[model samples]
Target: MEGVAAHQKRKVMVVADPTRESAAALEYALSHAILETDTIILLHVENPNAWKNPIGSLFKWPSLPSSSKVASSPSSEGLGNGAASLGYAGGGGGGEMEFLEALKRACEIAQPKSSVQTERVAIMDGKDKAPIILSHCATLGIDLLIVGQKRTLSNAILGHKRSGSLRGLDTAEYLIENSKCTCVGVQRKGQNAGYILNTKTQKNFWLLA
Candidate 1:
């Protein structure tokens, strides 16, 4: 009975990057959605350009093994030791490393560090960020996925672009529309005010902070 109950907790995956937008998504998850029993997965994707050298880049993190599912509550001690083992091997990945660490700090600030168990995953970005992210979500059986989004001028007026534009497919937009699980695109409203949320069924839904 204990094992079955433990396996039922929700799994929340928040895409983490150094951008202000990414921070807002993390903030939204921590503030409004997460619960005490939730397991947080912080996923950081590194652009190919950011790597410079694929073989030696410190940004490369091991991919999730094929057999893993989203377990209910991973051990806090194990998470700590695993993170410590993933130290940078001296390269140009400092900035990316700092990004995930900052997001983790946000997690800790929201919930007592001892109570919130978290996992960190860094992946090398492929041609399209959304598809790779979607694949991982499926692999992990994530319950909720959150990614930060900035409302572009075009999107604000025409909804989101239907196809790849000069800037390519909007990752957050694609995820919100297509991810298998419930996916949220959170946009912070300036430096204050509140937030604008986009989901599969809603667009520009405002939530006053």
Candidate 2:
């Protein structure tokens, strides 16, 4: 047993989102997975909007800080900065604070009894979520990636184009097909069919979403 990897803790990254499916997948991993021999990292990537001005490149601030007014407001309406507005408001604190709170809540519910440690950190500025995740895996020596599968209509209809925003696939497709590490696409609670984890025996990573 000593030479058989010793059941080392598996680094699992759960891509957190505002959807019920994501939550379900997270809970499943916690309850069924090796709690003492696995590390779960929950990450919430704020998507970039097409309308925000690229001011982060010219300024010292990493992405724009959210407005106090926007953060204080109770409404969840879209921001004016377009793409930048999509992720974390214009500022780092506004949108990020909320993301952290959500991540903590998710962990509390998913791994109530498990003593596993988790880190809820924001994606680096100007870096896409996919690449950031991959980089994090390499830096942290992660062994696996767990992502929630999003459901979308398979039929696009008469000449209607399929939207990329239908599910969480866009954020994960690249990693699924090209990651150096193993990636698991969790469609529902305990469901594991849309993709394969054995990197040596699979081709074409497909996530329903």
Candidate whose lDDT is highest: 1
After superposing candidate 2, which stretches have Cα over 4 Å from the reference? Answer: 1-7, 47-126, 152-169, 189-209
Model 2 lDDT, residue 168, Cα = 37
Q: All candidates' lDDT scores? A: 0.63, 0.47
Give the lowest summed-lDDT range of ten residues in model 2: 59-68
Q: Residues 1-209, candidate 2: write the lDDT tens digits.
A: 13426457677777766454555445445544435445667766655454546553232211111322233333425543312333433235544434334444334433443344455446556666777777777888877677654443321121113243424345545555556787655444123332222122343334332
For residues 43-128, write the lDDT of model 1, one tens digit per residue: 87666466455444443332111111111124232233222223433343554334356446435544543134344444454466
In terms of TM-score, the best-performing candidate is 1
Evaluated at residue 50, the lDDT of candidate 2 is 40
Error of 2 at 125 (Å): 6.7
